[model samples]
Each structure stands twice: as C-alpha cells, then as structure tokens.
Target: MPTARAIDTSDRHPIRAFLDLRWGGPTIMLDGRAIDAAALPGFVALDADGAIAGLITLLDDALQSEIVTLDAVQAQAGLGTHLLELAAERARALGLGRLLTRTTNDNLDALRFYQLRGFRLHRLAAGAIDLEREADPAIPLLGRHGIPLHDEISLIRVLGAD
Candidate 1:
C-alpha cells in the first residue's frame, strides 16, 4: 500500500505536472468557477517507488472543507480511500463541520464511492455542467459510460462531534 502525506510547497512542481496530465492543467471548474487545484492544501499518496499514486486537494472555508479533486492512479487499490481519510482528519483538526465534494451526473463511480464512504446527497444542480461548458468549451458533452454530462451532484459527509 502507498503512504499518504501532506502536500507542502516543495511538492508544487510534481503536483502541477500530475494535475496537468490528469486534469488538463491545474485549474478545475468548481461551483461555476475556475480554481487552481495545485495551490490547494491536501494529501498525496506515494508508492514504494516514490512516485505519486494518488492525490486529493482541499478547499476549506469557515464552515466546511471541500474536496476540490481526488484521483487514484490505480483503481480499487484503496488509494482514494486513504487520501480521503487523511483529508477528513485534517478537516476535523481544523474544526470544520463537514467535507463536501461535487461530481458530474455522468460520473457514476464517484457517486457510488462518496456515498459508500458516508457522504450523502446534498443537492442536484441541474444543468450546472452545461453552464460550465459555456465558459470552457473543452468540457466534454459525454462522460463515463457515455452518459450525457449535464448536472452537478453535490455530496457532503458531516463530521462527527469532536
């Protein structure tokens, strides 16, 4: 299993490269805005070879911690879960009340992954992605399993009383 660690300033270059390769550059569209995910504080899981295996970037506000991005180089290997666990621990330490994330309607895998790990449906922003596409035309019309990517689904996991 890979070990997860906090992302520090020294990690910027590699993180930026990783995000660019996987996410089409470090800027990710969230809640109708473009966010520089590489600039966010989060966790990175490294394999035995010292290569990044997975990563999760967080955006925290006074009320909650938002998972801006989560990616695992190898699926079903528990890397994603480990990264999420670390994020939750950080959120709890910061006195955040919940962990939030958003996924496209076409991303059935993310919907299942988040829910199975205690996240619940928060809202369905219908046609959210379509509006996002207006700003960034590169946003694909179809996503995983060939589903039409139109809506944005928000999910939240409320932290237990600390």
Candidate 2:
C-alpha cells in the first residue's frame, strides 16, 4: 500500500506535472469557477518507489472543505479512499463541519465512490457543466461510459464531533 502525506511547497513540481499529465493542466473547473489545483493545500500518496500514486487538492472555507481534485494513478488500490480519509481528518482538524465535492453527471464511478464512503447527494446543478465548458472549452462532451457530461452533482459528508 502507498503512504499518504500532506502536500507541501516542495511538492509543487511533481503535483503540477501529475495534474498536467492526468488532467491536462492544474486548472480544474468546478461549479463554473476555475480553480488552480497546484495552489490548493491537500494530500499526496506515494508508492514504494517514491513516485506519486495519487493526489487530492482541497479548498478550505469557513463552513466546509471542498475536494477540488482527487485522482489515483491506479484504481482499486485504496489510494483514493486513503486520500479522502486524510481530507476528512484535515477538515475536522480545521473545525469544519462538512466535506464537499462535486462530480459530473457522467462520472458514475465518482457518484458511487463518494456515496459509498458516507457522502450524500446535496444538490444537482443542472446544465452546470455546460456553463463551465464555456470557460474551458476542453471540457469533454462525453465522459466515462460514454455518458454526456452536462450537469454537476454535489455531495457532502457531514462530520460528527470527534
């Protein structure tokens, strides 16, 4: 299993390189807003070889922490879950009440993954992806399973006192 650690300034190069390779650059569109993943604070999971196996970036606010990006180089390896767990821990440490994330309508895997891990559907912003595409034309029309990526689904997991 890979070990997860908090992302620091020294990780900028690898993080940006990883995001650029996987997501076509660190700027990700969420809720029609452009967010620079490289600038956010989050966690990274490294394999035995000390190579980045997965990473997650978050935006912490007054009320909740939003998972801006979460990706594992290899699926079914528990890397995603580990990163998510760390994000929740960080949120709680910051005195935040909730952990929130958004996924596209076509990302059925994400919907299942988040829901299975205690997240509940909070909102459905119809046509939100369409608006986002206006800003980032690279937003694909079709996503996993060949489904049209059109809307945004928000998920939230409320933290209990720890």
Model 2 agreement with the true structure over 12-39: per-residue lDDT tens digits: 9999999999989999876556789998
Over 1-162, each residue of candidate 1 has an lDDT whose tens digit, in order, gives: 898899999888899999999989999888767899999999998889888899999999999999999999999999899899899999999999899999999999999999999999999999998998998899899999999989999999999852
How does each model score on TM-score?
A: 0.97, 0.95
Candidate 1: how large is its RMSD? 1.1
Measured by TM-score, how close is model 2 to the native structure? 0.95
RMSD of each: 1.1, 1.2
Residue pair clashes in candidate 1: none
Task: Name the TM-score of candidate 1.
Answer: 0.97
